[model samples]
Target: MVSERSSKEFFAVTLRVWRQAGPSASGRFVDYPATNVSPDMSFLELLDVVNDGLTVKDEEPIAFAHDCREGICGTCSCTINGKPHGPGHGIATCQLYMRSFKDGDTIIVEPFRARAFPLVKDLVTDRSAFDRIQQAGGFISVRTGAAPDANSIPVPKDDADLAMDAATCIGCGACVAACKNASAMLFVAAKVSHLGLMPQGQPERDKRVLAMVQAMDEAGFGNCTNQYECSAVCPKLITHDFIARMNRDYVKALFKAKFKPVSSASGGAG
Candidate 1:
């Protein structure tokens, strides 16, 4: 990547930013010319330049969420050019670069469209629904004690690998945005499978899955139609396989509840 500080070459592009005053306010696309944009600059950096121009003109800068431009924080989420993370596979929005677009290209930026993710401002949405869903059952309760050896508990290599894969989900809500129904099954499934596959997670496996699914429903997210759009835009590349696994678990739990015999006691000598 060539540095703008060292290179004299700068290109121009147009940014179609979505502007919404508030959650209930009607939104519109506002075009801003980004002149002298360095090809080496990240997508967020380009926005920074545009915002600086807006600020200089005594205009409100575009409000967007970004934290760790290194692509790990998962906060730099935006629907770029009709794709999450901007025309890339297995990468977050922060990982997108200006070079990905040609000079004079028009880039459309918008927030993740979902009922659960209400618009907070221009490009920022209240994604706290994910946090609430996580809080429901995304944990394993265990006594805190001295650190145990890594191999103390025997775990199959495949299960460990799958758990790690599922754990890679950063809860960015990209899956929700990409789904036609705005389903969060992929996200919830990832969280459920990540813990359900591990030995430490065994104690609360049944309770965890049921609670998390209920929380997700209460969050106003739609149901999965098996379109697999959620997996397509996931920055972590979380597979849809977890969704099937979670469905199986949920069905099994239902059957278990239906068949469990109720205990009856008789008071003798009363």
Candidate 2:
């Protein structure tokens, strides 16, 4: 159903890709020339063209993970030229286009590197640590009978706006990749702040902070070095301001947990 005449404008580029046989296998960078690549094609599409050539040569195709290329799903994670989600600002890997690079230029691609994210294969790293963190009180447990009418509850405009901003995180692990210490604080802060801002989240706010922070630490994630690289590389443009908010809440929670009022009866018995 397709013809060469229908092809869009084409250019050439060299893809220097990381190749790993498996999680336990050694990895290295392999170069492949992608010729006649359409300028309008996305970076993933360019890889497909290179893969087609590899298939014809009976060679192993590059293994990468992607779903919902429109950028909502965070599965399309790749470190292009040492940057998470390629070189684009506030965009994910799927949003990267071939036109961003000059013709005949070489693009280096690799998987996100972090102690918490283990390599699955070429350009694929296991990000299940995020799931575990989320499971540890990232949500509210409320029994509100029905979906409340819009604006039913009076919420402060500033709080609502901040909540909405924090809610945009797609959990792509870009923050972790960008941080020198490989901290997950940005991601955790976003999750906590988004929920803590709303009325429905107030009930579990203290518990949520304590559990999620503990879970993140137990997952082998590094500490926040305050370098702010996490915010710089975030596709959602999530600010590091949320991390400060989380720190304040976490300290309060710790203090609340440490001190408790003594019961008169218990004190008399002691």
Best by TM-score: 1
Which residue pairs of candidate 1 clash? none
| Reference-based TM-score of each model | 0.93, 0.91
Candidate 2 off by > 4 Å:
1-9, 148-150, 262-270
Clashes of each: 0, 0
Q: Model 2 over residues 138-230: C-alpha lDDT tens digits?
A: 988967798878888789989999999999999999999989999999999999999999987998999999999999999999999899989
After superposition, candidate 1 runs with Cα above 4 Å error:
1-8, 261-270
Q: Candidate 1, residues 1-270: lDDT per residue as tens digits?
A: 454454456888999999999999999999999889887889999999899989999999999999998888889879999887789888899988887887889999999998999999999999999999899999999778988887999999999999999999998999999999989999999999999999999888888889899999999999999999889889999999999999998888778767878767566556
In candidate 2, where is summed lDDT lowest over 10 consecutive residues? 1-10
